[model samples]
Target chain A: MNDHSTPILASQGTPCLLVDEERMERNIARLRDRLRAAEVAFRPHLKTAKSWEVSRLLMTTPQGPATVSTLREAEELAAHGVKDITYAVGISPDKLTRVQKLRAGGIALTILLDSVEQALAVAKASDPKDPIPVLIELDCDGHRSGVKPQDATLLAAIAQALAPRARLEGVLTHAGESYEARGSEALSAAAEQERAAAVMAAETLRAKGWPCPVVSVGSTPTAFSAQSYAGVTEVRAGVFVFFDLVQAGIGICTQDDIALSVLTTVIGHQREKGWTIVDAGWTALSCDRGTATQNVDQGYGLVCDLEGRPITNLIVTIVNQEHGIVAARQGTPRSDQEFPIGTRLRILPSHACATATQHDRYHVIGAGQSDVTAVWPRFTGW
Target chain B: MNDHSTPILASQGTPCLLVDEERMERNIARLRDRLRAAEVAFRPHLKTAKSWEVSRLLMTTPQGPATVSTLREAEELAAHGVKDITYAVGISPDKLTRVQKLRAGGIALTILLDSVEQALAVAKASDPKDPIPVLIELDCDGHRSGVKPQDATLLAAIAQALAPRARLEGVLTHAGESYEARGSEALSAAAEQERAAAVMAAETLRAKGWPCPVVSVGSTPTAFSAQSYAGVTEVRAGVFVFFDLVQAGIGICTQDDIALSVLTTVIGHQREKGWTIVDAGWTALSCDRGTATQNVDQGYGLVCDLEGRPITNLIVTIVNQEHGIVAARQGTPRSDQEFPIGTRLRILPSHACATATQHDRYHVIGAGQSDVTAVWPRFTGW
Candidate 1:
């Protein structure tokens, strides 16, 4: 942002991703400290900050105890020397070869499943000497894919199907519904429900004589608001690595805690309408309107100065593929002189996970420093 | 899809992009024939399918007379032997160096701008011996950036500012508002308005002694619905290469005309809730709900079979980071046996440009063939 030999954002070009390392480290520490106090293992989901530099910082060790949404992330992390990972998404038969390859490459990778069909597929794919680790996903508040926590019959059947061929690691449940919970009490209740559901499912598997060792429960909101981890062994949460407007809207993190933003340059303006057009549209900031249903809708994103300070009442109201129209939140006409052409601005995203996927690298602005000190690369795809 | 020894899709992986070559070629022909009959030169926008293979098919020749939204696209096209390109987005001062570099590399990359500020920047950056070509943008409808078509004073000022230093190529206008025009009559009216605005701006510059030779006007909706391209010299439209649900909803194309889709594999199901979860979520399919306001709100996207046939009333109702919940439009409970785990499916996108941005490569199915014949790589970022 300031002079070294050159201006940081100016040299990098507009409409690019920026990571405030200071804020990101703080976010990482906050979660680490919280989980440590709760006595639960913290396996940060690497889907948000897909960069190896960021992943290395988030993991408990260089060998990891990390969570990934895809096998691609697991492979990339493994290349960076991360040995332990959990592919948290429910397993499908097609991805097992990649899982087997990762395991063959000396990485301890685990897969998740809910149905007996998936259990049998994992069993078929596993080698008896190095049986693939499996987790039975439990439904926490019925938000998404998972076997209902009370479905003891399905749990026992899946566990029995994995016997001798695949190691039944434990049960994992995500408090995805926790994202919709409002206020502290509601968030706390959602967290408790997630914790209880995972414990109950693990107990269900254990009652049937399966060694269900892990009880995993998480979602950014629940991870921060949970009253207790109780019987949970580990927690997995993404988005928190780069808390976004959606998180701020959900009371999971404050606006100042957000570490990621899209740097842009104002290119044109419609004076009468008070709309300042910037070069960072959906292609740069992503088309996630996650805050639209929140108590206060942050349309597209909140506009900020080059220093990443939010401009009061300013947000991106509309976006084309390569252009964003920024206007006052109240729709009041603003003088074109305020955001003249070539003025540099940054936009905080509506959803970090969605927005981060738009770019392949992050220009890291060092902690308390203006200059960009590092560039961390990221990857996408299965 | 059936002939390959190793099953094309089975080997590639799920949540990948698929381009039906037959459908895409038809889409391209439909637009080309329409613009040709209208007597306007087609300069297809390459922002939707940012692949060299697709660009080669869209361009008039390998040395193209093409349109691009970003300089990155321009450079990529140039690398693929495309010589003539119009960077359709409003240019900023920071990008001037790149424009100079592209020109130095023997690529004729023209830039767009609308104000005296931008004109001065261009003139300053331009070498008098090899002047930078500039196009003054005119606002067809109060949709996005550009100077008002009737703003004669500003138009004259910008033209004067570019005199002798920069080449004022002509005027360009995009009927972005056409995306909201519901009926055929409304779309045709929007096209007329766009042509009128561009022609008016070109005439305005010409009256002031500027040689405004080119008058470019287009938008996907207007490009196909235009009853007349009377004063427009060239037509520029993206997304027509792979018409999406939004285009179909607008009555510009039918659902069968959509050529892009996300291939996914069902991973889990909630039978009682009627949810069949797949591995393609917002990350793979994009979070563009462009059809939400249409007559038929195609929730995330219209669910399709592996062969590209839309399953009756089925759509991706909800999406997480790496999970999409497919369900019937009527919300009736479905049996888990209907979409058993591991079942392969394809989902048509709500917006092709947004959806295409999520992946790096397109697995192309040859014309009238089920087998994936090629993998065209794509690049992203500024």
Candidate 2:
């Protein structure tokens, strides 16, 4: 970042993707070791850390398993020689072809579907050569997907209908709402609630004589705080790979633990409007509109310097598709002084998963944030 | 979309890119004919229309000309036989390797650089065998890149510095701020302002004895407007190919003209919270903060039916990386009567480019909305 002769490509360009490689390596090691100590299989969600370079670290571990929200990630990760992947999104009758194509190519693929209708559709359409193995989703957080744990009859119906043709591998749940917690204290409690609910559904399925191997409970907040695994066999969490402002706001992870950021340049100052325009717009930093009532209302994200510290109360308050408005952190934006145009800065994403998808590569930054060690290119596609 | 069992390999998933083949064809035809009538070269910006399929259409217009924002696009377009490309993004010294690689790969590439330091960097790093040509970017609206027109002395100095080792081709300016205008009237004024600024810059550069060939002024909103194209040689607007909510919000395009939207599902509901959860989250819709202001706060996007019609004012209100919250359009979300889970809905993207990055394919919905036509796939890479 010093007398690098030209603008540090790392310090220049707007709409840039920055990864704290050191922090990422630590997160990877922690997750791998924690699961090993607990004697449970670990599958890091590739959706958060989209970079194959970061994801490659997992292959060195025992259960180099991974999870994805789209078929694109499956194809990309598969090409990278990291095979074990679970397409975590609910399966529709249509995506079965993409799923089949992945499985046919020799990638161990697992999918999730909740309703009996969807399961039946997938089972009916699945090829005879490679039938689909599905994890019946269970709703623990009351946030999304999965039937209620109390609806044992409905759960049995879905499993029964899907079991004949499709393999009912396990039950999966995500306490996504755990991200709404105020602190580790609340997050720990949310974790317990997530575990208990998922376990209850697993027990209900067990009582009905179903083979639910993967009693999954996932969410960055819950995954970090859950003291008990109980009936869970596998977990499916995504955001832990690159904790964001939202996660830190909820106390799931500290600001120091956050790893991903959007690199931007100070473009111009609208002194009249009191707005600081940066090159990183909604296009570079994603539009994860998660300004919870409690969390810091970072317009889009917190603007930080190269050392990774917030620049005053400055937060990107408004953003167009390719334009962002940075304002004073304390009050309204004051475009009084001019930072040299093209000054490099980083904007931490509100949600890691959303921001990671926008960029195809990551200029991995490391070496105590002073000097970048290497530029590792990652893949994103189906 | 239909009961067609062919697995059209598309027509499913939220945050999906829909190709308004008709509107696109029209937009393309109109731009070509209008530019021809104006007697100005039309070097369409590929940044807005990133599809090779779309680029090919522009190249086929006999102009055989185009502009690119990323080296990846230039390489891809070159592979597709598109030799003439202007790399619009301001390059840092580090990108010298990429520029060299592209030049050797046989791409007729011209890049943009503003200062003498960059010109010197390029001259020093570039292979003597493949000296680069540069477009001295001009600041038209004081939006993003380029030297100020009034600073003719500085422009001449940089141009002369790069002239020995590099060909100073022309001046290009993107009236990106045109999108900030509300209607055609505002766009017209912005267009005139942009044209006047570009002309003045060219006049100043010419007076300094620099033969700038490409005098350009463009933004999709002003592409069709702006009567005075004096001294302007070409247009470099991009977003006209794939219109979105931002365009519609600016009254440049109608909602019916929007070609892309994500098809989602009503996953669950929080009755007490007055919200309905949709499968389309920020990952699909993109966290593109907003445009102009937070006024059109389509959290993730506007939820519409499969056929494409807004559902109440119930903006996607809030979104997580992969989860969207839909509420009552008129008032608060009233999930009193349980919305039978597993309902399919479409959420129009706030910006087509950002949202399209999250997906792998475009499910071309037929005119009837739900009828499946053909599937168009896109490739993303550096």
Scored by TM-score, the top model is 1
Using Cα atoms, each model's DockQ against the true complex is 0.86, 0.24
> Per-residue lDDT tens digits of candidate 2, residues A1-382?
3343234544444467888878877776776677667776667777777667777765444235888877777887888776678877777565677788888888889988778777788778776567787887777777766677778887898888886778778777788777677766888888888888878877888888886777777877787787877777776666777788887777767778888888776644545455666667666776665654554676688888766777767888876555678877545545355554456778888778767777777877765675555666655543
Off by over 4 Å in 1: A1-6, A331-337, B1-6, B330-337
Looking at model 1, give its docking quality level: high
| Tens-digit lDDT string for candidate 1 (A182-259) | 999999999999999999988888888998998888889999989988889999998999999999998989999999
Return the lDDT, model 1, position B223.
93
Model 2 CAPRI quality: acceptable
Error of 1 at B17 (Å): 0.3
Against the reference, the lDDT scores of all candidates come to 0.89, 0.72
Chain B TM-score of every predicted model = 0.96, 0.89
lDDT of 2 by residue, B113-184 (tens): 777767777777766566787887777786656677777887888887886677778777778778777766
> How displaced is residue B132 in candidate 2, in Å?
5.7
